[model samples]
Target: MAFNNARIDAVPTLCASCEGRKKGICSALDCEQLVELAKASRKSTAESGATLLGETEGIDRYANILSGVVKLTKTLPDGRQQIVGLQFALDFLGRPYCSESPLNAEAATEVVLCSFTREAFERMMQESPALERRLYRQALDELDEARDWMVTLGRKTATEKIASLLLLFARHAEPPEKTGRHFARFELPLSRADMADFLGLTIETVSRQLTRLRNEKIITIENNRLVIVSDLRRLKARAGNS
Candidate 1:
């Protein structure tokens, strides 16, 4: 009975059953603080392809993604765009203390956000050192991911890039098993064009690499979206992680 109660505590009554609360920065707050924060938050949803924040958009709020995927793009004035990053459930979105967004954030799939005014969040951070520490750690994690992805984009081959993208989605689908020996399934958040853009490959290169992986018995594609990774060990090995 005690273990069951502890399990139930994952969904404390102070807020909706958001994974963000369990794994996100909200975990830094106690129940009373959660209630206070809730008073200033509003739940909102964005459809796929909706722009959550545009480049240079005035930043007024911060959000914790509750579900689905958000893609970040870096763009040029000439209309060229590169998909720079992706965010998933329980990830914090938006830059606090910044007046403008440096990248465009768009929904790659339907998304839910628990968002509150930046003023309210800043006040909470000032009052709670724990929250400030949590935000700092989240920012550090983002920096590390960005560095790793830079290697993937700059050094990985076409096949390696495709496998790396699939491996990323697989890890996001569930905590990656040791050596990734376990199977995983997830529908891709981005289309072929978006994947190409994100991986710095052409659409034809992405498609050809996917075909190679399929023929090699590493993964299977269905309905042009659903992906089942069977050979995760091989897939990870091919992802060029050394």
Candidate 2:
């Protein structure tokens, strides 16, 4: 996709409220520091399924999700691929001290990101102990999530795998109360091929399993998006969770 060259300030966002809201890293930062960091950030957009950075790419900048989701994927020599991480709004990007990226950071959907040069961002982090501490916590949390996904992909049944993924989407999504039952409605950010890579299944299997879920009244699919009519507890049971 051709990228638009809009200025950073021209990008739309509510700086102060965003810094104080749920699912936002800014909420954890002091106002003065947040203001300082904001001044250094630049905004960019990526279309759905765009590769923002590849494994072979040198790390030049650090980024944070201003909106939409990103997928961190690794490919094996034999062509096998796995999505190791999913980054949502207010999530960090680029390993702090790394010179080269180990995986591809792709936009799972049309996304807006706030970026900073790697060297400057790292130096700033060093000068700001509170920011550095928060980043450390973020890394640990991401590692824990990676481990959890590994377990799901390795041991879960196809149905359970899909259910777990759906539940996670629900957990990260905006308020359900505002949209009524339609709150469960949202597009799958990644394609079935990407889903297969993440779930350790073939694309055909993923498609079939999704159909089976709908056939069993577990979910409904329309235009490739899913709607979960059942409560989360039921979905978790389908996920084989105790």
RMSD (CA, Å), each prediction: 5.5, 6.5
Each prediction's total of clashing residue pairs, residues at least 3 apart in sequence or on different chains, is: 0, 0
lDDT of 2 by residue, 36-98 (tens): 566677778899889988997999988878778899988899987778878887888788788
Clashes of 1: 0
lDDT of 2 at 235: 69
Candidate 2: list runs displaced more than 4 Å.
1-14, 19-23, 78-80, 176-183
Evaluate all candidate structures by whole-model CA lDDT and list the values in order. 0.87, 0.75
User: Which candidate number maximizes lDDT?
Assistant: 1
lDDT of 2 at 206: 87
RMSD versus native structure for model 1: 5.5
TM-score (all chains, Cα) for each model: 0.90, 0.84
Clashes of 2: 0
Candidate 1 ranges with C-alpha deviation above 4 Å: 1-16, 174-181
